[model samples]
Target: MIDPAILEPLADDAWPARERKRLGGWRLNASSGYSMRINACWPLAAPDRDVEAAIDAVEAWYAARGLPPRFKLTDGVLAPADLAGQLAARGYREGKDTLVMVGATDGEGDPLVRLSFSADETFETVFTASAGDPEDGRERIEALGRMPPPACFARLDVDGAPAAIGVAALGGGFAGVFGMRTVPAHRRKGLARRVLLTLLSEARRQGVERAWLQVEADNAPAIALYAAEGFQPAYCYRYWSR
Candidate 1:
């Protein structure tokens, strides 16, 4: 089994945030406040100060930035066991349970899918067009641009029009997939699967051993797709906000 403790930092580094700080092992991140992962605090380990004091600091930090205090609690043995109860007592309600999946990276890619070292205009166009929330889309697009090297953006087209897109950030023998999107008219066409496989193929080329991605628990179709690709749940995390 893939260890959540080891995989959490890889995923965080793959998707960068605009502003970041640390309270000992706890990670504080904030950006446009649309994407919960970037804006929420990740309590992966114990803080340096008292747990209550650390929570207070997190609240004040977000307040200073005109955003709500939020925490990302990974549900596993590595996470601080009592932190959830502490947040609950402080009026933090749990939201958005997301499953983290892990899979092997040993497959061939679709030659039809174009892979770029950066996010190109067509990639951005398809991503923004398919996004339901403009601000959230914008935030994610910017994050995609900020990802460091050893990364690639995948785009697949049908009838000379953009159909689907995905991004992979690679490092330390791991590949983290993000920003998988498909045009509305192109749904159920296996475009996403092509994009995913293409990305994984590239990761294998770069010597990546494993691939990981986060998907909301309610997304049944996405879960099925990941499962079919040999991905299994490594762990799950939830957002906590007052």
Candidate 2:
């Protein structure tokens, strides 16, 4: 079995959205439909019977909400041995394997970057401005805002222009990095790296030694950048949906 010390903190870091319901040992998170991480049931533990019951309850629950049934499976938890088999029997297919990476929090940000925890209108404005599509952007902003305490928003400005944006959540002895984005003209300028270091530095200052983040397995640029920063992939997780 994977150690609870590692499992619980990773879950808290990645799936920090509000809980719509707790069925069996799974967490049904549906605060937003834009991202499966927030919309699926996390099957980390439970008996086979409870898992089956949860499978039924979750399908109905999401059906009532006019959404599809989904599950997030990770390698580290007390999941049933046949969890994947059961989902496959229900015709649920896997999607988007993501790597969970961890590393030491070192190096302060570039002189141009700034970290802010106020989460005011200006932060939302700048973040959504560069993010694609207003509707999805609003969903992301709301989801990020709804995350539990010990969080902040980071921005990088060049010549008084907002160049990049990132969000960091501190919990469970780790600084969780998310929403790292650099504007079109700012890509290749290392704004993403600056934002990451800025957040990691702040996290370290706050007495955290470790930092973590998630990246799509196929995102080579992001994976390369993080690898260069000394982050090693700890595990993988994927979503399954019918």
Candidate 3:
């Protein structure tokens, strides 16, 4: 039940590139290359029908759209007992191990952090500075272009330029936080912490009591930072790519 429940914010925080469709009890999403969650099959329920055919349908759908076939499956109660085996039989390999961290939204905001309602130049610049290229920043902005209501982007300027940036979306009593990035030269500084605390404060202002974010399992610095901010791992998920 936690799996289905956790999906509430994820589904609510839809992007512009999202082309979501239902396959029996599964949600097949193809968002081009925007975000992995929107481009992977969310196998939520155990199908009573043709499971293999359903899997084939999903693969065919992604192939027709020229998307890499991917499945985002969580551990324990969130994943089907036989899902891993089924995917293995299909030549699917695991990719991008991630952890879903949860925390409270009672932290105080920092005056240095500035929040915006939409993707502006400052936000783009901070992203470009951290993402290492303009194409990655543009792709993210393209996805954020269709972000739903009650979303906010946070930026922290250093030496009159944006050094830290993050984004959050409030939905279903949870604030979905992601894309927290800091410029290379600005790393090891406390700008990211300020931005995080500020974003948590904003989430509280938006009436959200809980905060959630996904980070790659191998990201030690980020995991340590979030843990220090009172965030704890709720579940783990990995992409199975065919």
Candidate 4:
């Protein structure tokens, strides 16, 4: 079983300041208010008799901020007796399920067929060419460029045209795989898989032993690819929006 402690560093690494901290081992991450990735509660510590008090504190914190209380519980956390039922009783409706896929970098399946990583210009070109909105793409590119160079990005180019983009952030003995996107025209050409492999390679180069990523449960294709790449569902979590 994967230990919940593995997620401790996410508070400062992945989560942004807009994410609000709350009492009772709960956090109200408002950074991406409407996005499942941002708005959720993570029980960093094991629940005990004080679990109710912790829930109350979180609810109060949200109420004080004029935001509805939202909570997310993963398979790693659900083993706590009645945790889900407790949240449901307090009007927290379940949202879509997501899988926490994890893998180690010691062994790789296959080398990416045609993928490479370069500086800002190359990443910008791929992001701009693939995103639906050119302006939004530029903003994303700029944001990613500001990140430390250790944050590796890989682009899959097909016939000299940018087809997919992948990014990984290294920290705290782990590499987080995120920001994966493929151009609509290049769907199902194995571009996503190639990009993922490239990210893993980058992670391995960074001396990161473990890699982790999250994907919606309904995204069967993505889940299948991760599974084929030796990733296992270490846990599952769901978001609730009021």
Question: Per-prediction TM-score, please?
Answer: 0.97, 0.91, 0.91, 0.75
Worst 10 residues of 2 by lDDT: 1-10
Error of 3 at 49 (Å): 3.8
Predicted structure 3: lDDT: 0.78
TM-score computed on alpha carbons, candidate 1: 0.97
Q: Write the per-residue lDDT of candidate 2 for residues 1-242, one digit (tens) a residue.
A: 23443754465545455456765567777754766777788776673457778789888888877778888888666577688899999899988898888888998766677778856666677768765688767777777777777786788878887778887888887788888888788799888998899888888889988888889999999999999998988878888987
Which candidate has the highest lDDT of all?
1
* Cα lDDT computed for each candidate against the true fold: 0.89, 0.77, 0.78, 0.66
- Write the number of the candidate with greater lDDT, choosing between 3 and 4: 3
The regions of model 1 sitting more than 4 angstroms off are: 77-79
Which number leads on TM-score? Answer: 1
Runs in model 3 with CA error above 4 Å?
1-4, 8-16, 77-79, 132-135
Summarize candidate 3's per-residue lDDT along 135-182 as a digit string, tens digits: 655666667777787888999989988888998877777788877988
lDDT tens string, model 1, 55-157? Answer: 9999999999999999998877444689889999999899878999999986779999999999988889878766679987899889888898989899999
lDDT of 4 by residue, 15-94 (tens): 34354564534555544233444445666555443878777776776677666777776655533457778777877678
Model 4 lDDT, residue 164, Cα: 80
Of 1 and 3, the candidate ahead on lDDT is 1
- Superposed by TM-score, candidate 4 places the C-alpha of residue 145 at a distance from the truth, in angstroms, of 7.8
Is candidate 1 or 4 superior in TM-score? Answer: 1
